[model samples]
Target: MGAVASQDKQATLKGSEPSVAPLMRLVEPGMARVNALILEMAGSHAKMIPDIARHLIDSGGKRLRPMLTLACAEACGYSGENHVKLAAAVEFMHTATLLHDDVVDESELRRGKPSARMLWGNQASVLVGDYLLGQAFQTMVQVGSLDALAVLSKAASVIAEGEVLQLVAAKNLATGEEQYLKVINAKTAALFSAATEVGPIIAQSTADMRRAMAEYGTQLGLAFQLVDDALDYGGSSMTLGKKVGDDFREGKVTLPIVLAARAGTTEDRTFWSRTIEHGEINDGDLERAIDILRKQGAIAATVERARSYGDKAIAALAALPAGAHRDALEEVVLYCISRVS
Candidate 1:
């Protein structure tokens, strides 16, 4: 994208949407510690382990997952340093997932750069991912919070299961919104819930507080993923960090495609089958797909669904203590939805 176009998009993002800068500033100190710990933990005797790990970690991701952990802990009045360790662990887990996901999707780009798999080969990517997971577990063990460990461990398992579920659902026109929601809940929301919940767990907060954070994370994650799904089809590639229509090219049955397929006519369904299910794409297939999504109002419906989840996320914050952290967290949800809006 051109500088002028990027500037206009930034202006649009600043006008009505809540920026994440508040949240980033709120957790900056904890994030500094978390960043150092992440680098320390990612180290290994083998040169390739750090090499591959640093490649993706240094890539320009927002590091939102770990920041959630830090923010939640601070919001709950946590004083100890365990939250820092937990935040680093959250980042490691997220990085590992991205490594595995790139390999599975056979993706060439991540965050608008060549993916780790693309540079290091699939075998190296998978192995480095495994190494990171092991490091994450070790860091979690050091925290000495069994409950926090349990939450993250369960999330790891659910994320793996979600990936498998998505693999099964890919290219299947029969996939519905319900199943698609389930996939995102496991794949994306599980980690978010875990990342946020660990904050209250380590803070020794009340059950109500824990539940609130978990709900907030889950709803926020759903909203984030739904917005991402919509952006894949309707937004700019520069905003997405990956090429537009990647979901369509991979035949991933995201909510937008599910809604579009449901609202489409017989010929529309046939077109989806030919291009998405069968992968027999032609020169203008992507443009035609966008036309169909627009005609069926699938993109709008998906954004509405994301807005509903964003509202739920804000509601979930009612139980948390009121402060800058809480406000930042709420804004984070709005920020997620506003990318497409």
Candidate 2:
């Protein structure tokens, strides 16, 4: 498909009305600059680096984290050019994580296409991911705001720690909600909080505003991940870009499984242990897993948790001034929750 048609396909993946379209509309101009910077920064003489990076970059993610940076900065009255650089940096960090993640997950598809690792090999994917991190840092330095740099740099570390935590926790049925939250907060929410927090930091907004933005992004990130886990079982390949039950196949102990396992009967517990803990998943196992999740109210519970976080994300915006940008930010929280509904 053509570029515009491709983007339209991505936008409509959620249904007749895409949740993120409003946020995209509000941030399109700023996003244009960020996109330009992304392309400029992704260039390299090695050719392989840029080729692999572009394969992922040009893939049809909504660029939600970077958009959060631009939107929050706009809401905080930041007209400075640094926001564009920071937004690009946010995207680089995110893209780098995805590259690394697909390698770790051994995922074949990303955003409805072959993953970078699938085409380029694991070694190249890892090196390209490192290259992206270098580019992300360079862009942050160009902004020349130590505060923004500190927030993002710290987030980069936290994201790595989160990745490690997930690795250690992977396939362990004993993994509780608390451990799971720490994993998601570090891997997912840390970048989000950093993306939004750096905006206010660059704008030199009040401490309260910065804190509020951090909270908003943190909660929103949690909600985003929760919905993603829910979708793995309930959504389609068209929506998720991978086959449904990929997570189950991979033995990831996400929230729905965690909840369902906890509430399961002895027989159900044995089933989880055999499939998730032991990796003995068979054909019909995914369907049985979904039934167990439904019977335990795990799916509904997961969505409820997401809704609670979405409410908190919205509540954080109250500290900011009333305006279209702020309203759009609030809509983003709703948009996130709407994916499951």
Candidate 3:
């Protein structure tokens, strides 16, 4: 998640395109099982739950997190079928979070389509999210590993805590890089770490190896989120799945803005205060913000930061066994950081 792959399929950058197919290739069979299980478990008596859940589920995503579970288990030499259940559980947890997050962020679009809250009401989205959470736990229980269950449960709690923390920090320009990192670490990295950790926990691998896998996922997650933050301002709506500048419009104080604010002149600080702190955005504010970020090298710096975490992720993989799965995992970190390129 070891050394960055030198000759893998994902070694070359493709502008804003993320390289996930190699990882997908390595775990295609397992991912198929996870997908089938997801569809089966999404069923409900009410029908609405499946409808709303599938709306986003069917939308194209790389399913990177679930792949990590499957690949990590394979990396740990797990021959059992329990990883399929764990992988599906990871995806359910992710989809549930997306549904709840869209409601909380008041987002209208997700994965290039109408958000669940846009078609269904906020109540429906919230209820469907709860339904998915129940399904996730049910699948986790099916895995029958108490340690895996414990890790996932803690991740669920930490994800909620991260969301609450972000809400508290919203529109607060005083929030610094450290505070923002804490938010993403809990919100995003916790699940990622748990996803990989459960694989070793199920495989009954050494404690050192399990910890290494967890750290690998944690660093990869941090790199992934930082790149996403950069893309929100710099990438297109087609690539980002939502409108560009959504964070700015919503007054989310991300890393780029944090860097710019710290490096900007007094006039730039005033602009930041008006747009991000007070929500007094105007027509050209987004453009101005982008220009300021460019001039201040905020975006470039954020990409550099992501690369650092990607390197750390690769280093963490050193403790895992060497094989195609391990190599694919290393390429994943490279691909994540490449999204910002």
Candidate 4:
């Protein structure tokens, strides 16, 4: 399955969308240290630990969450090395979640390659995920900031709750927009918020600055997930790092599906019921689902919602001191939303 965008639209997007080059360049030095720390922490006496960890870590993820921690700490004028440990912890937490998520979603692909669960089996994937989480906490302890540990540990709990909430809500057509937002808020935004918040905590920045960074991260995360939800129905596999209809096929009710199902016709409702609610998907069901989403303008609406959150994220950045890091962070938000444009 592929997206609906044409060659002309892709060409236009190339010129219009913001590039992540600035953020990447700004964080390069810190990310080098963070990368090395990640590898060191992931190592263990058991060879399978590092092998499974390296498989996903070496995969071409953008490492955006850890970069956010590095960028925020620098943006706040921190000159200490604890930020490096914190950044590694953030990445480990993210990797662990991805490993666990593959098992939960029964996903075959991640970052455009076979998932760890597919190659290593579900038991290995789950155990490796647990091992990574332990490493993450141990690294956080090394950071010597109780506040950072509190924030990240709370995020871990919230993420687990969010995953459970999503599992309970799966394939339930009655699930509304509010419940859907709650699910993403816990599942996605919690870690993003924690990732940015720890920067200020480690930097010993002002309370106001910490609040501003937290808000920025939360809004950026919401925007990021919303854009991903849109892309799942309207993007190419190369662009998404997974199949286009994975959400629909898995019976996950994201925002686009909620909006479309709410406004669709009686026959459309029945179609959703059978395919999504009852998991009775047929050969052409994915294409039909995409057509309905397009017809109802759900995809466009989802992108618009993401842009609104992106605006809030940028607004939150205003509280920070002006510098290249701040500007680069804003660009990161734009780059995230630009995936579907």
What are the Cα lDDT values of the candidates? 0.90, 0.88, 0.89, 0.90
lDDT of 2: 0.88
Cα error, residue 197 of model 4, in Å, equals 0.8
Residue-level lDDT for 122 in candidate 3: 99
- Compare candidates 2 and 3 on lDDT and give the better one: 3
lDDT of 1 by residue, 38-69 (tens): 98998889999999888888888899999999
Q: Give model 1's TM-score versus the native structure.
A: 0.95
Clashes (candidate 3) = 0
TM of each candidate vs. truth: 0.95, 0.94, 0.95, 0.95
Instruction: Give the Cα error of residue 106 in candidate 3, in Å.
Output: 0.7
Give me the runs in candidate 3 sitting further than 4 Å from their true place.
1-18
lDDT tens digits, residues 1-341, model 4? 01222223334444756767888899899999999999899899989889999999898998999999989998998988998899999999999999999999999999889999999899999999999999999999988899999999999999999999999889999999999999999999999999999999988999999999999999999999999999999998888998889999999999999999999999999999998899999999999999999999999999988888888888889888888998788778778877998
lDDT per residue as tens, model 3, 1-341: 22344223345544334467778998999988999999998999998998997898888877889999999999998988999999999999999999999999999889888899999889999999998999999999988899999999999999999999999989888889999999999999999999999999999999999999999999999999999999987999887888889999999999999899888999999999999999999999999999999889999999888887888888898887777788788878877877667
